[model samples]
Target: MRRELPGLGSDPASVRQRIEGMEQILERMFVVPGINKPVGLDVILSLIPGVGTISAAALGSYIAWEARNLGMSKWQVARMAGNIGFDMLLGAIPVIGAIPDFFFRSNTRNLRIVRKHLDKKHPGSRTLDVQATPGA
Candidate 1:
């Protein structure tokens, strides 16, 4: 007799998988395709007038919620939100924004933030604690 949890329900792995998928979308589709010439879905979809960037940002925001479930700190969530905000704001600035989107991927940055925190909290993962040093 066990009560089921809410979001995660019964699988921690699914949460991890989802985060990984989002990271891939950010890295492969949004960032790397431009340099490598593979032509990702994100970039192709971004050809639309306004729907492209907005939809991508909405999709990326889910990672922030997932990061919270994974025990990420408020600062981490803020960083994720900031990344998405910048992606959206700058993404609206015509050609300049479009060019940056092909390189300066905020979703990837957010994913890295979540992964860094997860690895810190979970056992058997990389334990790199980031702390302020003396006289920096």
Candidate 2:
């Protein structure tokens, strides 16, 4: 029997959830001190010079890969790949790499692309956003 990993489903809904979760982990996992901005593994990993940038790029590429798997058009996939490539280049710079990586969230951009596609092509996968009431 083949074993399926959690969050690795092939359905559109599953894929949507998985990519959203990944984007959260890669782009909004933590809050920065003082500046009060959200950051995630993408920025944090890019701080380790060579290895970190590569690792972060690889993770970013996974989003593009998922986009391709969702039957997105070649142009969209290429755009996604371009986003990841540009991010990788930005991250390759030494000393100040993480600064731009913090602001330019390639994974978040890709997630937006993926969500657009899913919303149009797989409307059934649409999920409602629930926000908490202030001081409720």
Residue 29 C-alpha lDDT in model 1: 46
Candidate 2 error regions (>4 Å) = 1-6, 131-136
lDDT at residue 54 of model 2 (Cα atoms): 93
Query: Taking the tens digit of each residue's C-alpha lDDT, what string does model 1 give over 1-136?
Result: 9775543442445566677677666546433445543334444435555787787778878888888887778998999999988877766765456766666677778867866775666644443445356588
lDDT of 2 by residue, 9-119 (tens): 798988998898889999999878998788999998888899999999899888888888899999999998899989999999985999999889999999999999999
Model 2 — which ten-residue stretch has the worst lDDT?
127-136
Off by over 4 Å in 1: 1-12, 30-39, 124-136
Going through the candidates in the order shown, the clash numbers are 0, 0
Each model's lDDT: 0.67, 0.90
TM-score leader: 2
